[model samples]
Target: MKVAALDIDGTLYPGALGLQLLQALTANGISDKSKSEDVFKVVEKYHFNEIDFQTMATSAYTLFAEAIAGISQAVMQCIARQVWQQERTKLFPFVPKLIDILNSQGYSLVLISGSPDEIVCCLAEEFGISKYQGSIFATHQGKYTGKVNLLSGSLGKKYSIFLQMIKDWRVNLEESLAIGDSITDTALLQ
Candidate 1:
């Protein structure tokens, strides 16, 4: 089967979901405002090509890890949904149509992002996608341990995930297409 590995942030949507996540965390009092400010600075630097994608991702991950450490899984999921709803209007105009076309063409759509698992899964479901890979947070007794296993934004990691997905979904690499708008997605795009 053919697959489409689509990056969520900056591909389907117009900005990083990390900002929305930070907003949600701030609203919920889970993160410090200063941490959010730091992320903004990193994003600004990245925009000017002063910093690379990995730096932005690392800063976001640090903030996310600190904010999500002790939150319960259920609460985090709820926060994720709220953030999604608030930012739903930010999606690109052609995203829904593109997804429909891909689906009609029998391509298995998979959302591959560095965003939190809950947020990415929610988005995948909202967009009618059946498969996804996202950052996983280690949980202990239903609470986040703050440790993340990010599968995106690294050299060779996305390729590894692609290989695993091939086994899981019985997909053909030669027939698959990867869509991404960042350096982090280079491995899969190649």
Candidate 2:
């Protein structure tokens, strides 16, 4: 199948959705005040050009990993759904039209995101994308182990994950397309 890798945060939505996920996690109590402070500081540094985007991403992901450790996937999924429902109105109007056109053309849509798997999967299902991949929080039995198995933002990680999916699904990259924004998406876009 020809693949279309779509980034969720900015491409699918009119603006960035990263903070919405963070807010959901915080509201659900997966993240504490210290973690919030740390992530905010990273954002501040990135905004001030004191640190590169990679550093900001790594720091934010680290804080997220620490905050979400040991939480059940079910709980996270619930929070993800709630967040989506609340923010659904903010989604860009053209995204669905684009998805329809892509679908009609037989492109296999995959939502590849640095966001949590819960949010990515929920959004994928809502948008009728059958496949997706996102940062995986380690799970043991039914509960989170609080460890990140693969981070989408880590250097080369997004490309590796997409490459594996391409191989496993027998996707044709020569006929595929990737849509994304931000330097974090450079690997996937390439």
Candidate 3:
């Protein structure tokens, strides 16, 4: 099947999904705030362009990796829905139309994101897309384990991950479409 690969952050919405998840976790008191003050400072620097996206992403990833430890997957899923609802209005006007068009054409919509998996699920559900991959926080028996596996790093690594996610990658280069907005997406786009 043809795959319509997409990124959720800047490509689908004008904001970063990972950042929003972190903020929501902190706001709802689901996250441990011992390091939030410093974390937000890194985020602020990213907003002001004082630091790069990688730096900000790494900082947030590290913080949330620790904060979400022991949080139940079910609770995280609920918060993911809440975060999506809160930010749903911020989605681009063309996104739905584009998704619908892709769906009608039978292209399998596959989202590959650096955002947390819970939020990615909401995004996939928004467009009726079933296939997606995202940054993972290891969990056991429905609770987070504080171990992280982020996909926001080097393109080479991202490319390898994409290969692992796609069962058939060689045949889709011609008919498949890729939508992305950052260097982190080079893997799926290629």
Candidate 3 TM-score, C-alpha based = 0.86
Give a tens-digit lDDT track for model 1, residues 1-190: 9999999889988887756876788777876667666767777887899988777767767666666777788988888888998887888999899999899998998888877778888788898877788777788999877667664655567777767766767788788899998777888999
In order, the Cα lDDT scores of the candidates are: 0.79, 0.78, 0.78
For candidate 2, give the lDDT of residue 183.
71
Cα lDDT tens digits, model 3, 1-190, are: 6778888889888987767877788888887777555667777887899988777777767776777888898998898899899898899999999998998997877888877888988988877877777889888999988778664443445566556667655546578888888888776676
Minimal lDDT window, size 10, model 3: 151-160
lDDT of 2 by residue, 1-190 (tens): 8988888777777654556777777876686757766777887898999998888888887777776667777887888888888887887888878999999999988887887787787788888877788787788888877577878866667777788777768777789999987676788788
* Candidate 2 wrongly placed segments (more than 4 Å): 15-18, 28-30
Candidate 3 versus truth, CA RMSD in Å, comes to 2.3
Q: Could you give me the TM-score of model 1 versus the true structure?
A: 0.88
